[model samples]
Target chain A: MARVLTIGEPMGLMVATEPKALKDVTTFRRYVCGAEVNFAVGMSRLGHETAYISRVGNDPFGQHILDFLAEQHISTDYVTLDDVNRTGMQLKAKTLEGDPEVVNFRRFTAFSYMEPSVVDTVQWESYDHLHVTGIPPALSETCRETSIAMMKAAKAHGVQVSFDTNLRPALWPSEDVMRKNINYLASLADIVLPGLGEGKILTGFETPEEIADFYLKQGAKAVIVKLGTKGAYVKTTDETFYAPAYIVENVVDTVGAGDGFAVGTISGRLEGLSWSEAVRRGAAIGALQVQVESDNEGLPTLEQLVAYQNSAKLSE
Target chain B: MARVLTIGEPMGLMVATEPKALKDVTTFRRYVCGAEVNFAVGMSRLGHETAYISRVGNDPFGQHILDFLAEQHISTDYVTLDDVNRTGMQLKAKTLEGDPEVVNFRRFTAFSYMEPSVVDTVQWESYDHLHVTGIPPALSETCRETSIAMMKAAKAHGVQVSFDTNLRPALWPSEDVMRKNINYLASLADIVLPGLGEGKILTGFETPEEIADFYLKQGAKAVIVKLGTKGAYVKTTDETFYAPAYIVENVVDTVGAGDGFAVGTISGRLEGLSWSEAVRRGAAIGALQVQVESDNEGLPTLEQLVAYQNSAKLSE
Candidate 1:
């Protein structure tokens, strides 16, 4: 089986314990860091051979993440421990009063201080596929350089690279800086996944087609733009396709849905699924994600995925 | 001054937000609820004549007792929104490993269903102390009867009542039950203040006692239990107090630190040096809150009370 590697900083996540506003609630739940790590855990649960790469603090939270990775069966051979800084964290308020609000407490955190010294020790040649995201580039200069170095090393070792533009405005200095940095990272990937809104911001394109075209021209072999309930748009060298969103009964949270879509598409590619089938899998997984609370907790096992796909077809 | 009134459920508050456990946060903050209607908003800041009394949703959380009234400017105009059902809410998580843990979801949601017929219309003749917690015996047959009857007749007689036990649970069998039962009818209060932690189940409490104990004894006058940086906790009786917690370098959040303790404490009590010299002003304000993330915000505002008492002693 081909081995898949995902790298990024995962910080702690705090979400509202109930539907009440933040000022109203007297409690909250806690979860460990990074968006990409969440997806890695999901893919590993689907029985894929997956490895995660990142740096974490030397504190209990870091140990907790490591223990969590081991429990999820994702490889942590490439993970590093930082002695000085502590882990990062984010708090999501339980408010429907406005746009889903998130308060980040990750400034100057250990994840943002990840250095090239940590990256230099990784064994890049062992993985068949590598997944990267835009967040690392915006964290710190050292992390940005590490992202570029990892991509270059992966290319040299003939590993396919997939990139997700998980834009977080609070982490960056300005929109222009974020766009420039993210676009630069996209140029190093073979596959690019960008959410509809994120794609618009990164490529300055209003429509998915325009966004996909922009990435494809930048050297991505294929580009997929995630459109929440409406599905996704895919573009390749010679053709493009549109996949409709899977209908879900409720959308409890939309936080990790995009990451779920990326997992489906990337894992499908590794398994040699058809382009259409891969995008279909992406939409299917994304649909499941919104119905649950955690970022990757609702990801389906391979058997579950097949059953869901089969049921969808039978219903049609 | 103007007389203010409020009505709603008051829940037991346990906060678990500090780096240490719940016991450690004890030195953190304190305040009470059910009585929170008077102390939290009505009695302290508004300086209006205020009264509060309600049977709490019965459970260990029901220990709210007379604590809500002793600390603020509230009087026991009508107290008793009690129920056999669980008192809603528990400690909110400060870390990211898990979401805020709840003891129960208020299985019967007994507080909101208070009956209007049982409230004695003649009860409003005593004076101008009108306050209420969101939870009342109203959740069940006897409780609801007491709340509706008391509130409607009070309003007709020009008595001002404030309602604030913001939201208990949403899965109360139906939405119509929630909207028609909870907000629309409860909004008749003269002043209303529901906060972040008060609205959802998670992402709220950081400290417990400091957040829940500012309200006073049920039979007494006035209350307020919000614990914002240890500032402010007012109640009627013959004494009032103010004590701020030791300053901290970082404030994770100041969510419910204001509302759960503001109502009656700042608005109701008699104003004089004697009124400001009591430790119950701090003890009632300093109870078991501040350990959680949301419910109770911080310690009682007792420094002013101590300073005033010391000055009175020197004069004597």
Candidate 2:
């Protein structure tokens, strides 16, 4: 039995080799990156037994993703193969200043058309935690049903659930439907992690406290509000805390910082850490993630995490 | 029967949507862009009767490429479908200041594995001009042999040949091998087009005149030296001419500018334009290409070219 299970579509990632604009670039590098896969990789690096369950195309890119997971020592037995469509992908270009430009290439991607019957083979009772995001549902109706089915099965088996509102506006038809469906999913999760901006848009809340409160009122056991570089705010039935951000000298890439934060929080909680301690670990890991490129390449192992924490205290 | 025939691998192109660093990009857009296809598209737009000969994977991308060629009204009857390897692709990143970054995904590509047997199906006697690049030879041994075989067949059938020294450093084992192979290819061409930098490195020549002289001595009837934004210098058996640069207002993308120049020069020659007129058209097209984003999107139509030339003369 794994400590954590994450299910979503993993896409082939294409990036500019240098910090040149898209029009001027003559070369690029390739990798596998997705929000769910990032979390799975991060959790596995942090000494958790993580299982990634999803469908990938039977293409070279799909093989590349499987090979990558094998190298990371993450379990993929639950992943199915799709023959009809090719794996999804994304292209990224970055400049010297400001946020990176992103474009989605997942329309009619293989995973979007994954049959619901494939999820029946997944062992529901073998995981302590189930982590999901809003992307799979918005991909296709079949994927939406699969997501809902997985959530229901996990709940029935008494597994803890974590849902991140990783909303992609381009994937959805309208804001109203997105909010309705995502909010419904939030009610099924034990813990809800949503960025301040995402929560504000989904729930029409202006402040972090209001955003957290909205989710908490929607049957969540706890709500963690991500505030970008300012760290996160946590609100539970009996307690609350504001975890301060760790300052890093340079911010190289910001793609998978949130997933890193999720890994830290999930791993810390599973290890029986205090709520504040878990949030602190999350902040530390998230800060470290921004200094490196790639989604999971910057993830720290459990030993490295402890060393970073100890070194910071010693220097203070 | 077409005036121009181009032989090379046409790869699918995946690009990042916005100006985001590789590590921070979360999405991408997909298109089909390659050196040969770029040249074919440009020439077709310039009113040249062009035929493209190559192999593509029997995949959606291949189908898409066929559809795109039809949309552009370029002939694709000579394109073969491969059952084994998939179509090659390149990932491009959006640029901010200079040239956009490019990453090649062409290993074991279907076009690289093109069998020499496929060339038997191509009608070599019908074409007036055949344009070849160094990339086909660098792909694989099979592709290299096919390139050699095609050149021999074209020459045996009395087809004029134009070769471009589009050097890809990473594709070759060493600089020595690249130079040796490229120079041998130059010997087979009636007219050779080499960038100033490429000519310097390949022939160890300091001046464009020296580089042109070297190729001319190597059996080339003429040589045109590309000087980037400075325009081009042409040396033929009859005369020598230097085309002045056309000043662009703002440079958007520069990926396919060289190919655009090739298209203009080839179309001009086929139309019986004088050496100076051909080089001038090349410079005008190259200048126009840098102001557009996609590699082949900004190629000027025959009407556009005439209007541009007429307007420029009026302004002067």
Please name the candidate that would achieve the greatest DockQ relative to the true structure.
2
Off by over 4 Å in 1: A95-99, A313-316, B1-316
lDDT digits (tens) for residues B126-173 of candidate 2:
789889998899888898888877787789899998999999978888
lDDT of every model, 2 decimals: 0.60, 0.81
Interface root-mean-square deviation (Å) of every model: 14.8, 9.8
In terms of lDDT, model 1 sits at: 0.60
Q: How many residue pairs clash in each candidate?
A: 204, 33
Query: What's the CA error at residue A25 for candidate 2, in Å?
Result: 1.3
lDDT string for model 2 (A91-188, tens) is: 66754533566655566677887666765787776789999999899999999888888888889889999999898877888999999999998888
Query: Which candidate number maximizes TM-score?
Result: 2
Candidate 1, chain B, TM-score (2 decimals)? 0.48
